[model samples]
Every structure is written in structure tokens, then in C-alpha cells.
Target chain A: MDRKGILLVVSGFSGAGKGTLMKELVSRYDNYALSISATTRSPREGEVDGREYFFRTKEEFEQMIADEALIEHACYVGNYYGTPRAYVEEQLALGRDVILEIEIQGALQIKKRFPDTLLLFVSTPDAETLKNRLIGRGTESLDVVEKRLSRASEEAEGIENYDYFIINDDLDTCVTQVHQIIQGEHSRVSRNLELINTIKKDISKFQKG
Target chain B: MDRKGILLVVSGFSGAGKGTLMKELVSRYDNYALSISATTRSPREGEVDGREYFFRTKEEFEQMIADEALIEHACYVGNYYGTPRAYVEEQLALGRDVILEIEIQGALQIKKRFPDTLLLFVSTPDAETLKNRLIGRGTESLDVVEKRLSRASEEAEGIENYDYFIINDDLDTCVTQVHQIIQGEHSRVSRNLELINTIKKDISKFQKG
Candidate 1:
């Protein structure tokens, strides 16, 4: 049986180590593909067009949204970011599991369109760890750190709806758990009923004679 | 966070290699405990009580049912068989994943009581393989083989209700998939919600200034 890949939406608070977890997962599993998102924001130095972001103009991004080409899209701080539907579908069709690292709102939107898609919420072991990690980065001001912590609290409320919660206390363990989750989903009988029935029919034929 | 063990019920048609797969799983994972069933049937030579079967008397078995001590029970041919609830619970409390290799009806009964129990149905890759395996055993007559094959068809219908379907085409692959299923179920947020919330509270307290 040709196994179809599962679409995984990962969302978490800032400094939850989602990007690092995703990198570890992709490196460990050959069947997983990290989805590349499109953005209207300017790319930083050394960032490639397809590698960092699709790098589209505001007009192009809006046009894509108007055409319903994005599986999940959102406006963040005056910049437009969205996952392209075509690329995700193509990867899934080729039997590669697609991981979409997105924010909560975008993740929810994708879930509405693809109810079967697996949604995982990543978080640090505790709020203090998350705060420390954010402050340790030295990229944000104290006010920004406080703002992100407040946002994290709000995000925690919606976590009950997620399919899985991965505690990012240890990178290797989290990645291994995520890998098992995807493998387990693929083994779901409901997803492979067609192939099972075919095997059953073949068995029945042999028994009749 | 302390992770709880999973209750796994595996059932399949005879000659589907369920026993072999279960043996392989227990040997590979140190934390998995196989539930040894209690039975009124006489034990074969060299079979020890509490190891192969609980070796209960008819009166003892009846008393167990009266006290609701059995997780699931049924009479096969002329003998009574069941899984003792206390033993399974004890193993689970010790943080070991419990594996119960029972029949389809018993599996469903267990699920009805413990809705969170993971049900796995094992089957051969094809009918020919099943037939060959049964014949290779050299213990049944042609008529018995025919009866077993007919029963296999009925059991396959129950596959739809199972959470996972493991095809015993290759022993190593089947065992690995079963391990993945158990690991995946362990990672479910529904199962780990309590621990996650406790961690969240601790983190929040630590973040308070």
C-alpha cells in the first residue's frame, strides 16, 4: 500500500524551541518535509528566496490570498505570512509528511480546512524556562519579553484542543516522540481501510479454492 | 513530569502471529508487561501458574466474575478464560505498559469499560499466508482449517473498530510498528494533560516577580 503523508501543524509561544525541534525531526526522519512559507517581509542577508521565505510582494501575497491559494495565512505586525496550499498538497501526494510551523491562529485556520491534520503544541518545561530562554536570546527588550509571556498564557488556554503536547525540555526526546506520533498516525486503520480490504479480498479468493 | 503507562489490547485471528509479535515486543521493551490470563482450563506440561495462565478453579473463576475482578472474560469451547483486573492494574500502576492478547469480543468489552485503552488488530499480509501458517503448524485437520479460515473472515470485519492494524508480513516490521503505536498513544495530550498542567503551574509561579 502506498502510504499518504500526514499534515502536521506545530504552534507554540515565542522561545518554545519549535524551529529547533522541527529541524531535529526532519533530520531524523526521511519521510518528513518541512513546509516553506511565503511572506511579504524583506529577507535578511544570506536568506535564499525558497529557503528562508518565498519573499513575495504585498500585491502578490494579497492576490494569492484572494485566489485561496494559501492553506493557512495571517497578518503579523503589518507583514503577511501564509502556507501555500499547492506545495503542501504536492508533498503530501508524494507520501512525505508535511510539517507546518505556524502561529496559533494560522494553525487553527488550517485545522478548519483539514480536520484530519495533526496539530501539536510545543512548550517549554515551565514558564520560567520560557522567560529565561527569551531573555537569554538578547534580541528583545524587557517589555517585549513580558508581552510574549502574557501571550504565552493566552496560548495555554487553547492547548486543550491540540492533538498532542510536546514538552521541549529535551530536544532528542521531543523529536523522537513527534516522530512516533507521525508514524502512529500513519498506522491508523481508518486511513488504510482500502488497502486492508484489498488484502482481505485476495485472502478470500485463496480460501474459496 | 511522571508519564503514565498505556493499556494496550491486541487481538487477531489465529495463525496471524499475534503470540510471536507479543513475545518480540515484550523482549524489546523492558517497560511492557504481558497480562497473563486466568483460566479454568488445565495447564499443559511445564506451564506454570501466574506465568502461562493463572490456573484458576471453576469456583474461583466464578467468584472473580461475581466480584467484578476480571477486566474481560469469556468461555471458549468448554473452558473459562479471563484477564484478572487486579494484576493488570498493579502492572499499570508500576508504570509498565500492559499488553493483553485476547479475542475480538473481549477486546471490545475492555474498551467499553476503559475508553482510553488502545486496541490493535494483527493480521496476516494475505489469505494464502494465513492458510499456510495454519497448515504449517501441523496440528489441525482440513475441516478445522476451513472453520478457522471462516472465523478469520468474521474477525477481519472487527478491524474497523480497532485503533491500529498491523500486518504480520514481516516479523521485525510488525513489531516495530506495534512499538510505535504504543509510544504514540503515550504522547497523546489527553493522556498527559494533568502532568502538563502541573508543569505549567510551576512554571507560572517561577515566572512571577
Candidate 2:
């Protein structure tokens, strides 16, 4: 039926492996597309524009915010990061389920803008695993890790607001569960109005003939 | 997590293959139990109580009704039929999803009683297919087939009220989709409050320690 794709807003704790899950989800499923974000932060190393992110000048990012071109935007670590409305809309129009992996603020903003948007909170089964993952990465300083853990505590309050809680205890299982949740939503009576209307009309014909 | 089971109210047109789908679903999955209905109608040959249907006397049925024992009840074809509240409650308490396959009137009544109940309406792809399925059974007369198609038209109006519209065009696929929908519901934030609270408390400990 060439149905329009779902607007999925995924948020999680900083060390919850949400990014890895999103990467594997898209890589495994041909029907999904990971949304690209626009950021004023300079691209690191080989991260290319429109791939890792749409690297924009601070002026450009501010203009997008002013023009309301971003679905949700926030300033983090002295740089403005936002989801590009155009790319997401185009991919959704093409019937590709777009996944926006952002924080709770942006996730809630997207939900407010698009009520049909599916809000998913990704996390580990417990905070111990989350903290361990952060420390195990061995890339960030202890202070940075501690700050992220603190942020996670605050984020926990918003987890209840999401539609689904995806515990990334196992990568493959979490991705499959996320995929199923999206697929199941497509059958929701509210989203399938066109099919419902078609069936209604189809049944009316039977009554007449 | 000792999560409580969902009260799943399933309804569909007369020939929607809901019964077969429910059978396959339970057979294929271990988590579901089809609710047995109490009836004053004489048990058909080989039908046993507590199996096919719970055979009851009209006096017993009326007394149960007076006691408000049935979740919902109605008279059909000169016989009384009802869903027993005690059995459904027991199954749900055991963490087994209870499926009540009834018509629009009963389904709506169950919804009103249990606001958290998940309502699923099953149907074929179109009215023509519905009619074909009814006729293809090679049991019902032309008169009965015509009557069912008419009833289906009226039921289509209530399809919108359901939470999900399950198109049973293919038996195996429909069963799988239904299973997925129910499984997905287990991860819904509202359904997993214990997990949410656990995660919340777990993360708070990280902040303090």
C-alpha cells in the first residue's frame, strides 16, 4: 500500500549503546533509515557532511532555528545540534521509517510537533551496565563519564513518557524488538485510516449488491 | 518482572477467520489463552463443558447475570451467551493474556469495563474476500451467507473504534502479526512500570555513588 513511514524518536542514556543499536538496525533492515542531524560542531576526522551529520556553520544553524527548519534543536557543549526537517520528511515520504536518535528534550519536542511520532527510550537493563559501558569504552575521562552518568539519572524521569522501553541488553534482540514495535504500530487502527476507509467502502458495496 | 497480563478483546465479522487465527496463535505461542464463554444453548454433539463452551442452564445464566458475573452477555439465536468474569480474571492474574473473541456489542462492553484492554478487530482484505471465505466453507446456505455479509457492513462501522485492525488475508502471516502486536505491547512504557521504576532507582544510585 506504499504506506507513509513512521516518525520514530529514539532517546537514551549517554552510554546506552543507542547509537550502535541504530546503526545495526538500519544495516540489518533495508526498510529503515537513520536520520542525519545538523550540527554547528566541526566534523571530527573523516566524518563527512550529510553522512555523519550535516555540518553547518553557526550562522546557518542559527538561521535554521530562526526559520523553524529543524524539528527540534538544542545547544549542547557550546554547539547547536538539530534534526533537519527536510531530510526526515523526504525519507518518510518515500516510505522509509526514519529513526531520530536524540536526547529526551528533542524526542519530546518531536512528539509534540508530530503526535503520531513513536517515542522509544533505549537503555540497558540497569544503571550498573550503563556505567560499566561508559567506563569500559576507555575513551572518555573519568570526569566526563561521571557527568554522563549524572545526566542519565535526570533522563530516567522522562523514560516513562516514551511509548516503548528498549533495553539494549543484547544488541540483536533489542534491534529486532524495535523493528517489531514499529511494524506493529503500522497496524494500529489510527494509522491505517486509509485501509479502514477502503474496507468501509468495500463493505458498503456488498450491502448494495 | 511479574508483569500482569493484558485483557485482549478481539472481535471481527462472522467469517473473519478469527477463531482459526486465535487457535493458531495459541498453538504457536504459549502465552495466550482463549476465553471460554458460558451459554444456555444445548451443547452440540461432542462439545464438552469447559472445553468448547461452558454449558449452563438458563436459570444459572440468569442468576449469574443478576450477580453481575459476566463481563458482557447477550442473547443470540434464542440462547444466552456470556463471558465469565471469574475465569478471565484468573487467567489474567496468572500472567496469561486472555482473548475474548466476541462481537461489536460485547467487545465495546468489555472495553468500557477494562479501559486498559487491547481491542483487536480482525477482517479480510475486502468485502468480496469476506463473502468468498464464508461461501468457501461450503457449509452455510446462500441465505446465511447473505445475512452475514449484511452484518459485516454494520460491523465495519465499529472497526475504527478498535486499537488494531488485523487483516487476516493469510492465516500464518496474520497469526504471526498478531503475536508480534501482543509481544510489542509487553514493552509499552505503561505496561512495564516495574521495569521503569527499577531503572529510575538504579540510575539515581549512580548519581549518588
CA lDDT, candidate 1, residue B180: 84
lDDT: which candidate is best? 2
True contacts kept of 1: 0.56
Instruction: Compute the TM-score of each model's chain A versus the native chain A and list the values.
Output: 0.88, 0.91
DockQ of 1: 0.53
Candidate 1 Cα outliers beyond 4 Å, as residue runs: A42-48, A202-209, B41-49, B56-60, B199-209
The digit string of per-residue lDDT tens for model 1 on A109-178 reads 8899888799998988877789889999877679877777876776777788888888889898889889
For residues A118-172, write the lDDT of model 2, one tens digit per residue.
9998888888898899999877779878888888898898888899987888888
lDDT of 1 at B70: 92
lDDT of 1 by residue, B1-209 (tens): 33677899998878999988998999987899999899998876777998878999999999999999998998754678899898789988998899999888889999999998999988887888888999997676778777778778777778888988878888898888998888878868899889778766665543434
lDDT of each: 0.85, 0.86
Candidate 1 CAPRI classification by DockQ:
medium
Model 2 is docked with a DockQ of 0.60
Poorest 10 consecutive residues of model 2 chain B by lDDT? B1-10
lDDT of 2 at A63: 95
